[model samples]
Target chain A: MDDKIKMKVQELLQSGKIKGFLGLRERHGQVGPYLFTDGDDLEGLVVGDRFKPGDSRYPLNKQLMKITRGDPSGCYGVLVRGCDERGLKTLFGSGQIKSEQVVPVGIACPQDLADACECLKPYPDERVAGEAAEPRSFATVAKVEAMELDERFRLWLAEFSKCIKCYGCRNICPMCYCSECTLENKDFGDIGSLPAENPVFHLTRAIHMAGRCIDCGLCNEVCPADIPLRTLYKKIADIVEEEFHCRPGYGSPETPPGLNIRGEELKH
Target chain B: MEYRTVLTTCTYCGCGCGLYLEVMDGRLVGTIPCKTNPVNEGKLCVKGWNVHEFVQSPKRLTRPLLRKNRELTPVSWDEALDFTAARLREIKEAHGSDSIAFLASAKVTNEENYLIQKFARAAVGTNNVDHCARL
Candidate 1:
């Protein structure tokens, strides 16, 4: 454990700012989400390398929301990286989590991890662990974007065609916090297709990410087919930005901007 | 400790739909649909749902590159632009106006698309401007 991180955790626990901490713990060589009741166990607060829990992969803003619901006055703290912070913001803006009831403990990830995940910003706004790095570029995404439409579509189809319908992309997305997903809907996506609808199912998810996908790249990581799902979503984000000039979390919270609007919302 | 949702629009396509972007710690993370919006009615197509992934994508192109001896090498925007203009002129002079066709992208703004078509018709002396969406 880094001394600074340990000290911060100690201070947070001792100050009674947080009832507990939820983070990864190495269990039988596999990382799992664990809850910490006190700062006394800083010894076990090791930042396990090569250990990523399913919880970390999923947008858990909803779970955190549940934690703060019953107790209106209590404040809770949780670990967050750029993706996690983005998830929190989207959830907060979406009415799923209470911002005031939670405190964020930021962690900066390394470039290798960022590259492997195709991550853009690997650091949070604030950090209690590790140093932050400049945001990386999505070369893979640009490569796909540079391709002609038919080439791009063909590439995507080839990738999407390999899908086993594992729902791992949705399962690993921290933003996919819904108890009932439309992708899982029998009528919308159907069932027992094994591979599911080629473009429809994936496109459904891509549309669902408009103004909300934090570019975490977890969907790509979780996809069994190694579908470059991030590229499609990235392109969609580019389209949204160019068309509407609205960035999801970069604007005023009072205004609901981006692709989530209709009717008079259309400037055209 | 404050988290909430504000209804918004999907900017990915011509069909504008309503959805909610989740924000926490002043950062974007995920999306949800606006149940009250008329377009989506809490339903989003694939593009609208994944609209947030590109803002901080690792693959975004911040610098222009040009092919040099069959290898893409990073170059200044000016150099790339000049090269492109010179090549286009050479091609037009050698093979006539119809030798080249301009393909526009749906990702560009309306103004940019208009400018592209204008440039194609007047400068390139061709009316063969097409869009990616047409495909």
Candidate 2:
């Protein structure tokens, strides 16, 4: 519910700077992603805070990818929180999109929301609204690390068993743009049958998340079975960071995803 | 450049999980679970996530097909229904009604499943009714 973003979108659309501005719209007591083509239609613009701060979140960057694919030539503006900026960077690194194609209206997430995500960077590099919040530690991953080996195995297996074979995690992911997904392969995945081959399915997705996942928590939020997929992906990203000194969504788009070395990380 | 998500119930099963179908330029693109719906509570099964694919699948059956000379050929609705009814009658007269098993599917609506059971028991005089989900 930031008015500054609304004014910025309105200005950009009226000035013909963008063909359309992708952001959240509040309509009829509901909030969801909306494309504002006209500058006048900025009354219901929001930053995913309907009830609680940053509660009603959607993958705006995914929507951006969808619309961009539909009209490849048109430049557009998009709403980007810290996580979304990271996703956009990852997408750019993967050659799925160009940074020039999108003008991100960056907004820093509130402290409460950052804590909820246990985010290391709650603010985007460039913020149009909201002050910077204290970055949070990846306590969720550490909590798992604190567990005994056998206990961790049992915990993960139990969590993975709850999967209803819902691809909500992949479908909502901003970084997932592959034409063919390995998770849906009929040969090895057994795509349709339930009681998913426990740790294999989840672990396969985790392996795929390395060097790609931006540590966004949409996978956890959208999961119907309450699986901590974000934790799994975060762990994978952390491992990649430890080994290669590379982190996704924070580096130049020239190198391979695993070899991406951010300027600051190189300094470290 | 019209892009919006239309909130609709997943047609895959009887669970009636609410999901938003992403419609870009009047075409169905993807499915996202409705976060506020009490039924699903922002969780979708694999079928629910992929409900949009069936809508635009190239292999989807638009017309009925009938076996002719060991090949499935396109047939009109009346011909297909009549052919099926005649075969059912012939089997029932030759064998017992229980020999003709009727299997239902979760893909179809509950009303269709109800009618299928009714037809199996009342019209066909058989209690050999089953559901695909049961298998």
Candidate 3:
């Protein structure tokens, strides 16, 4: 499977189809994002096995943003898993990156990884590695959804109290590419204060992620404070789905329902 | 075209979280937490997230500065070190050694911190030493 990916990347680079290939490289017992240019060695290329269930996956789309930002005209190839493809699609819909600038080499997640993420689609649009695994539901989300309003409020307050305001959730999110974030606004949350004002910080971020978050679970993984941020964002996704009849990154490239506020009254 | 991530330890605190400094064309661009590292496990604090900012910050002091005529003026390392040593000795002699306090920083290594406390206790004959994290 990896051989096919390497060959594809090499072909893309050799044939001048792509200026670079953004993927992972394992060297000296370490794996990190590596950009393989036309003449660079592809021997070290490998899909990172750092995927742990319920842990944050590397934001490959974020890395792609960096590459494409500087050279918008340059074509680049990127390794993408299910969540990564979703992130890329969302970025495309938002016009952050042109579709022509990217060529995704998709890889499906294994069953265990899929179960860990509780993902609905464990396979990308195009697959090069692994098998399509069954999608699972978020048990925690179900539990939260069962709770009463007061109970949910209390639960979220307790969870938000543990927040150290590290902004890992925002920083790790591939879709969160705004230069100026509302979370930093003094009106929303106090700056330089730990546990930034309970539900305000968390809820504000949740609102921001309503149509943007792709449920990659990177935020939950990167949180030094064990906050169930993924579940909260998942709930937001559900809300968006129910209200707008739109699911982020699931359909063709289009602006998210939250961002596509046309001057029209709702039919309902 | 010349882009790479260099793995290194975060210098902000004693936790020594592992991170990769993203370099583009020999200039520091950003930081990504080292996922495989046992210490941090891809987690970083706010300070660690902004580690790249201070590297190129205009406010960052590039050279030793000495307060001359009530204004900070850039000076040679030798002059700064000599001045610091002389001032420390003079203050220790004038006021009791205990009056002078030494503060260590987490940005430095354990050995360097140890040397600082040792210098305070032995050279100045004072136990008035503390760490910045404690404050």
Candidate 4:
């Protein structure tokens, strides 16, 4: 771990790239994210844990961009787990954040956390810490898929019944950066009403996450109901990968397939 | 600029996720889970994100008021508190202390709430105290 971190640091500093690295550092006994400047400390840099909701990697990355936007010619290093990398890709594709200013320091998540996330990729194209793991399929999605239409609907209702409208899932997601969200629009559903208009809220969110969700599981972690939200987005992400021939944030810096569909030549 | 965020916990209870008044200038511009917080790790629930709305709200009480002769009249804080104390005392004296129940607000601080309960139990001599969150 020490060697891997040192090599990355050396390369980052030597290449004259990145004004700073934003990631967790061990402060006394607790670990918290830090902004490491070249002359500052690197002794406590470590990568571990996949604590959802508590993890501010996504928001910190946004803060870095916000802070460094005026310095157009500057760059910074960001720690990206699989979900964060995917989020960065989607954000770049959507023009929410710039790619040039970001240097992804990738970290692969553990299997238990990956399973909880139902992630398709456990690592980014680069690795600065830990070995990558083969992506695993989630049985929860399969189980939901296998259910008959009514049975699925019933199950979903039962699960969604517990929704307290905390909005934890959307707030914690890296890919869910919107100046204004449609879910809150009164036309879609009643404001502050429980069970949220029978799947309108969740389904709308699922549809929005169609080509956007990075399977971070932050939503699931923050959800008070312990709803298996991962299944919903994972299934949609899988469909996006299969049908669109693309995964969110993985392709070249091109328009999303949904918007750039061409003439009938490409249509079935 | 004026904005408000409602002070509330993550609705995904058990975690008791605390979030803030995401005030921008004076308006609640956006949600930022308190960074210095220990519980939330600077993360907010979806509900916590918009917590500021209920504050600075057109619906929120801007001034104390009292209903007199079946009509609400805007009143001073002194008048409101005096009226409330007199009413409670009358109720306790007439119908017994148990008849005058005290329901506390979750939005208030622990000290405020403790003082209220103490006043109710010792002064008013009623244990009919409950809270929005029974903590």
Query: For residues A1-268, could you state the per-residue lDDT of candidate 4 as single tens digits?
Result: 5357656865786678877776655554445455666634777675645354224333445444443443555677877887778777766666666678788887777666666555677777888777677787777888889989999999988888778787877776666667568887878777676756667788888988887777777667656578888788888888888888877766765657564521112110
> Which residue pairs in candidate 3 collide?
A56-A218
What is model 2's DockQ versus the real complex? 0.50
Best by TM-score: 3
Error of 1 at A3 (Å): 3.1
Candidate 2, pairs of clashing residues: none
C-alpha TM-scores of all predictions: 0.59, 0.82, 0.92, 0.70
Candidate lDDT (C-alpha), each: 0.66, 0.83, 0.83, 0.67
TM-score of chain A of 4: 0.82
On TM-score, the stronger of 1 and 4 is 4
Candidate 2 interface RMSD (Å): 1.6
Off by over 4 Å in 3: A38-41, A50-56, A256-268
lDDT of candidate 3 over A144-252, digit per residue (tens): 9899999999999999999888888998889888877888887765698775887888888898887788888889889999999999998898888999887778877
Residues B1-135 of candidate 3: C-alpha lDDT, one tens digit per residue: 567878888998889988888888787888888777889998999999989888889999899999999999999999999999999989988998998999999988899999999999999999988887898
Candidate 4 residue spans exceeding 4 A from truth: A2-20, A25-74, A115-118, A256-268, B1-47, B51-103, B121-135
Question: Ranking under lDDT, best-scoring first?
Answer: 3, 2, 4, 1
Model 2 misplacement above 4 A = A26-30, A39-41, A184-194, A251-268, B66-71, B78-135
Interface quality of candidate 3 as DockQ = 0.58
Model-by-model DockQ, in order: 0.01, 0.50, 0.58, 0.17
What CA RMSD would candidate 4 show? 6.9
- Report interface Cα RMSD per prediction: 12.9, 1.6, 1.9, 7.1
Q: Which candidate is the best by DockQ?
A: 3
